[model samples]
Target: MTITALRTPRRLVRVRKAVTRRFARALTGDAGMSTVEYAVGTIAAAAFGAVLYTVVSGDSIPDALGGIIERALNTRV
Candidate 1:
């Protein structure tokens, strides 16, 4: 075999090993969200819930929902 042919397989093997190592590292890495991220997410979710509750608990929403329910109940089957 020629020198180039021998070097070709060795280079391919080295490249394959490097790619495998990188892929394995990427899979097993501790690349998750941190505590600060969790706190921010929690605060954001709470604020959203509060806003949603305030909107739903307003007088107009309840009155509209009650009117809908009354109309539905009064509809003849």
Candidate 2:
């Protein structure tokens, strides 16, 4: 085999190994926790938003707000 051909494969193998090591480190490192934390925070925020929406969409709040608006609009200008 020519020197050029043999050197090319070694270069490619080294590059491949570097990429594999980086990928393994990234997966086994603390960076992975950020994704889980973000997911949990997103879920919690969604749940809180749902609760607030339920409260605001309830009958008593709308009726009370409607009464206030109705009174204000009906008042003398």
TM-score of 2: 0.49
lDDT of 2 by residue, 2-25 (tens): 999999999999999999999998
Q: Weakest 10 consecutive residues, lDDT, candidate 1?
A: 29-38
Highest TM-score model number: 1
lDDT of 1: 0.96
lDDT of each: 0.96, 0.94
Cα lDDT of candidate 2 equals 0.94
**What does candidate 1 score on TM?**
0.60
C-alpha positional error of residue 30 in candidate 2 after TM-score superposition, expressed in Å: 9.6
